[model samples]
Target: MTLKIDCQLRDLDFTEVGTHAQKMEEMGFDAAWTFEAGQDAFTPLTLAAAATKNIHLGTNIAVAFGRSPFAMAQQAWDIQKLSRGRMHLGLGTQVRAHIERRFSMPFDHPARRISDYVRCMKAIFDNFQNGTKPDYKGEFYQFTLNNPLFSPGAIDHPDIPVYLAGVNPRMCRAAGEVADGFHAHPIHNMSYLKEVVLPAIDEGAKTRGKSVKDLHVQTMVLIAAGETQAEIDKAVEDVRMQISFYGSTPNYRGVLEHMGYGDLGKELSQMMRSGQMAEMPKKIPDAIVEQVAVIGKLSEVGPKVRERYEGVLDRVAYYYPIPKDAEIGNWKAFTDAVKHTA
Candidate 1:
């Protein structure tokens, strides 16, 4: 299968949005994404939609538990309209601590909660599309209020594709049950994906009389690459820290276990609880890094990524680091390489 390479803007620049989007589109990259980590996900895409044509845009993940279903539908509809139906809204139910402590939201039965949430959001979208009153009721959320005075009814594309971010089986299954696509967590390796994630999603789809082919599987590949071997080595070390951090999360330990590295995860979790951040990466050996991330010289990453994901992904996004103050954006080579022609 032919793969479509996508990238994300690390920094928000309204003035340079078109300049960047136009350049990426010309570079043959298929799409662009924004994250809800530290900034608003749609703002960058608002500028992107105004500036370019043809390139798709999405949120890598916006917190689903943080907002009401109607709010999500309204915002997603606006993005889809503004982007001319190029928006794919990606939602995620972050872990309980973040939900309860950070967002002050409840976290329980996440898979079932998200399933009901998506159902409610779609009902809202359907109401907007069909110009009817919102009359959807789910166990988690309900949208029964509708007034034409405030309703921005009927857009060019009411059915914006909804993708869900998932790392574990229940979330993966939930995505297969209701979402248009699945966003594989960056902490994942091929073995964890094959052995744990996809099979659960397949079963979820099967229960609904659907199949794996009905959902787009988009992976965020963690890679370590640079112009020189030294830079590559540093990047690898940096990514060991990243993987270690991911491993520290109890939910993600399953990935480490599936990869035969359960002991590594246990050590990292202890270090994390002790707040020994600097010493965490020391516990992750190079072999573990190799299993979790792609490592190569600048020219080699594209084909290598394609090799690893050949039968698995329909779309892939590269997540790596390049110094902002450097003379050139090192991620350029990664984008070009994944395009498979550079």
Candidate 2:
């Protein structure tokens, strides 16, 4: 079993990412993942690739709808070559609003679009490496690369792995059928993962005649560590606030409702729409917080995380939300404790 440690890019800057990637590599972590919500992940990833030599650098998820498949393949291939073959290109289809409204692009049939996008990317990489023209005609994308003048020329190809970010059943099955790995969201609980997500993956793999080992399962965990009770309370509140925001989204409401917190989802949704998001955490039920988060003492968090990985997850990515200047002693202590379990 390998233990991979990754922190969210939301809480870290470019300089911090390079420094932390080196530190995490020294700490025996297998990989470091960067995220993109509003900021571009490519710049920080390039810095991380330059700073670290061993640890794999990847995106927790780069939204596929924001960029074309050809451009994304070129960027991932360049990064893979630069990192000396230690790059994983993780992609996800975000909500329709981000695609249609924010980016001013078409958003239709996301499942099919993701499938076609992956095929197109892999075909482009293969064609570029073998010095052969790529002729692919999919429903969403069509490409014919036969011109030498526009080509980047024959280059050494690197093994670039693709992981899919999935939460629902159909997405999980799609990832299992085609993607190298499945990146699960942070709010999912162990029971839901074991009963819902893993079974779906297995079903899809069975249909495709692929072994379970061929599919990697990566999950995100929100973590905070502190000695005092008050500090721990603050950390828990921070996670609660994040969950509150996610619960309000229409796509994630079903997940919260499935966990027996449907009313809380409704309340949080109303609060978010009315511009009272900051106060919404105060109304979250304690049961829901305990079910979704790994809060409390270092000793307590280790076993809870281990429990989440018992039968389903292959890699666990911890999301650290503390400021750079803040004391990270407690955070380090928590990781040290969990290292034994891993």
Best by lDDT: 1
Give the alpha-carbon lDDT of every model: 0.82, 0.76
lDDT of 2 at 49: 86
The per-residue C-alpha lDDT of model 1 at residue 22 equals 67
Clashing pairs in 1: none
Cα lDDT tens digits for candidate 1, 1-342: 677788775574567776777666665667888888777777888888877889898888889999988888888888788888899899999889999999998999899999999999988888888866678888889999888876778988777889999888988999889998999998888888887778878888898899878898897878787878899999899898898888898888888888778787788888989999999988888788888788888678888888888778789886742233433334455566665656
Q: Which clashing pairs does model 2 show?
A: none
Residue runs of model 1 more than 4 Å from their true location after superposition: 13-15, 321-342
How displaced is residue 128 in candidate 2, in Å?
A: 2.2
lDDT of 2 by residue, 1-342 (tens): 634445554556666777876766655556778777767867778888889899888888888888988888878887888898888899999889889998787888887788888888888877767766679889898777556665555555456889888788888887877788889888877778887788877777777798556888888887654568888988888888888888887767667877887787778888888999879888777787787788866547766676556456777877774355544555454455555533
Runs of candidate 2 with Cα error greater than 4 angstroms are: 146-157, 322-336, 339-342
What is the number of backbone collisions in each predicted candidate, taken in the order shown?
0, 0
